[model samples]
Target: MKKIFLVAIAVFTLIACDKKEVDADANIHITGDVKGLSQGKLYLQKIQDSALVILDSIIVNGDSKFESHIKLDSPEMLYLFLDRGQTNSIDNSLPFFAEPGNIKIETTLKHFFADAKISGSKNHDLWKKFDSINSKFRDQNLALMEKRLKNELKPNATTTDSIEKAYKSLLTRKYRYTAHFAATNGNKEIAPYLALSEIADINTTYLDTIQKSLTPEVAKSKYGKMLNEHIKERKTLEVQK
Candidate 1:
């Protein structure tokens, strides 16, 4: 009887341990390695209530390997800030999307932001997709501006009309693309984020449509709340006009 009781207790202990491990994994876990950083500080930052806040901070010792865990209500953008106790602002912060799971970051202390490798978040991958599309629009705008500057063109009847037409065309294409993107990704958090950031001024009705299409959980997120507020303010402005 005593032997059987001991065995049962041991099995229960193992089960409890496994449950704890699973719970830990469900919380936010970040592990980092920074070469050439024997001692310093690393901070996790996020935007909250219209202000930038540090979510967590850790001290770096010998091997420059550090770990931190935090609770997340939802997936969102985060910044890794490295404070080397120097005046240089360059290469001090890196922005990445974070979700509740294990994340890893590896980089050198010198080029902290420039060469960091981050992985292990689904939301981060989605943000990359959105970023890739947004970058193309920026490249197109850059090409347009460069052509105008290089030509040393004067703003007159002959040149200004064509330039203005080109600008309008670019805006139209961007607005249409933003609408399509939001429609397709309505269930994802990135939909409202893009609507607010990429095409906030496109049209209030379209923004309203995107907001209405968001999943209930995403619609209640920080970015979603901001998007809703923006649409409301736009409507108020139109009424005043």
Candidate 2:
């Protein structure tokens, strides 16, 4: 009876340890982000010698956030792609000489690929970094829009001026974040400058929601036109050359 009892306890201990390992593997968190995008998608590919071995993709919610878990038996190059426009960015193939457990990569297009590495525990820390970067990007964009508006606007005009200010404000916020996000995170394939391709859509969505409060003429001011044209040209360059 004593011998049987000892065996039962040993078996239980092994079972418990096995369960813990499985739980840890399932919880290995992977995360990423893009700027100025309401939402997008990201893909992770396991590569060997510059060739893909396996591919895993996840949707970056409408808020431009994402999370996942990667199971690694060995170190491989992690390939990231933006779902919006077939954009591909790479964080130099990671050589996980150290056993892989949890890995987190958080960054915007502007500098995402430029600097992404194992951040922390790969769970909460990953989410926190993505959120932190987004918040910083928003704050910076607001400041930029404010400065640009003050420089360009007429102080005395009421309705037309207010509408124009609002339009520029919204566009500036979107463009600054999106453009920088892409630029920072992008690779040779999908550089951040390409974000300009979606500028019109972003502007249309914002203006349509507020159209009842502002006239078309005010939204199409010389400054607005100039801004859009400039962004479009940049987008063209990003894609073409």
Candidate 3:
């Protein structure tokens, strides 16, 4: 009987140990491999209430590789800081949108942010898409300016008016495109993100529609909350006048 009781107690202990040893769910697992960085500290930061808050940090020693895990509540932008002990503050920080997944970051110590290769986040992918569309509008403006400059043609009142109208048309098209993207992509977290990042300067009613059109999950995200608050504030201010 004594031996049987001891065996039962051992089994119970084993089960308890197994439960306690389960691996935690990491929202972000960042594995970084940096050349020439044998020993240094890297910090993961997020902006909160207009302040930069350090979420996590890791020290790389012996090998030039380090790993870090961050608990993310929702998809938002994050910054990686490399503290190289340099007096010159250039080429250090890399900002990337972080989703709940494994993200790989590989860069060298010489030129950190410029050479950094980050992958595996869909939020960042949407950000690139937004940038690509915005770039076309900028390129059109640059081309117009270049044509005027290279021809040595002065923009007289009539010429200036035509140029202004051309630019205005481009702006209007970009704004419409932005609104369409946000409305159609309302299920994705990027929808709310663009509402604030890209089209906030447009009409308040449009912004309100974007805010209201966000899907329940995306609406609960950080950027989504900001969109709701921004629309509310703007409407309140307009009412005050």
State TM-scores per candidate: 0.76, 0.32, 0.73
For model 1, residues 174-227, the per-residue Cα lDDT tens digits are: 788888878677777778878876888988879988998899888888778888
CA lDDT scores, all candidates in order: 0.81, 0.48, 0.82
Which segments of candidate 1 are over 4 A away from where they belong? 1-26, 87-89, 148-160
RMSD of each: 8.1, 17.9, 8.3
Worst 10 residues of 3 by lDDT: 18-27
Query: For residues 1-241, what per-residue lDDT tens digits would candidate 2 score against the true structure?
Result: 9999999999999978754223344534565455555665566665454467545566555676666666654322355655546555453233221114555555565555445444544222322344466566567657756755775675545655665676677667656555444334322112211232334344433322332222344235332333346656656765796
Q: Alpha-carbon error at 93 in model 1, in Å?
A: 2.0
Q: What does the lDDT read for residue 227 in candidate 3? A: 91
Better of 2 and 3 by lDDT: 3
For model 3, residues 41-84, the per-residue Cα lDDT tens digits are: 88899998889999887777788887777788899889989897
Q: After superposition, how far is residue 210 of candidate 1 from its true place, in Å?
A: 1.5
What's the true lDDT of residue 14 in model 1?
Answer: 92
What are the runs in model 3 whose C-alpha is more than 4 Å off?
Answer: 1-26, 87-89, 138-167
Which candidate has the top score in lDDT?
3
Q: After superposition, how far is residue 133 of candidate 2 from its true place, in Å?
A: 27
